[model samples]
Target: MTKELKESDPGSPSPNVLRIILALRKWGWGSFWSQLVLAIIASIILIATIPFVTRAAAPNPNVPIATAPSPGIGMGILFTVIGIGIVYFTAFWSFRYTKLAQKLRGANGGERPSKLQTVKLLKTGAIFSLIGMPVTLIGANAIVGALTIKSLTPQPTGGYVGVISVQPIDMFVVQASILTILAHFVSLFASLWLLNRVSDKPTN
Candidate 1:
């Protein structure tokens, strides 16, 4: 019956088009959900980090805490925040593929995108993921490197509790950055795979 319908209806999608549609739906939704979950988890971790990160290093102002975090740590937080925003965008972009699939499957020719448009759309998503990869990496490196350094060379605090130690906040930033990296990776992989599927040669 499926074959008969295809044979009878010249407007039915070609094999390649069907395959592309399938790829879009499968990887698209899968990537979106995974990215979203990771992003949400990462966001929560970042939020949980605030108290630990902002805690006073010493009870008395005279005993002194560093006036500010090192450049690496500060930059890490900045980039991580930016990367999270990008992850959010990529998550939605992942969802765009499923919507594109729906459009491809519609009967209205006007609603269907040209092949070039579709490929361009996939490329845009791929490029965004590419951008996100570096951003998240920078954040991960900065945060982890700074945290490791602080852990190894803890400040002299005369054995004061909570005095400029890295342990309290290290895991929080590290975990969040790691999740963001994984989410970006998922977005990139799905975009590239779907891009390949859509770029394949069509069969009659």
Candidate 2:
């Protein structure tokens, strides 16, 4: 019933120790690494693509109805970056779970986090993801909508007037936003799973 009793995994003979070990060895690092890796990839995409989006091909002067729609869609890049930031924050919060797990493993009685504290942390992470989901969705939708409009935009008398048209890079914004959404979802799921697991324990 104390930290001194060493057990590496959840099959510990002691019930409370088993909970601590299971949380630490199973979901603790699970949440940390998954969120971290996804967030990093998403952020990199955001950084690489946002600048190009803003600098999207200029308006074709020859076309009378020269309306380059990509710039407007570029706005999604901003929103997606914001979403990525939120995702990063949540990922960091998820890391705290691992740290908390370590603390739980090494502490006993008053030294350990209360069930309330653990639940609160998990709930906070879930809420963060809930908030981020809409932001990322908005970004993804905007980018797709704008790109679609650009792709279908009627050209000047010619089939297509100029090179200032949709390109493969344009899709990167959508990919980034989607990845961010994925990261947020991962964080959200982990938080809820941990929350439920912690709730089932009868510890203060």
- Among all windows of 10 consecutive residues in model 2, the one with the lowest summed lDDT is 60-69
The 10 consecutive residues of candidate 1 with the worst lDDT sum are 63-72
The per-residue C-alpha lDDT of model 1 at residue 90 equals: 94
lDDT of 2 by residue, 95-181 (tens): 788777755665443366666777888899899999999998998988988887777765655665653467666766677788888
Candidate 1 lands at a TM-score of 0.82
TM-score on alpha carbons, each prediction: 0.82, 0.79
Judged by whole-model lDDT over C-alpha atoms, candidate 2 comes out at 0.72
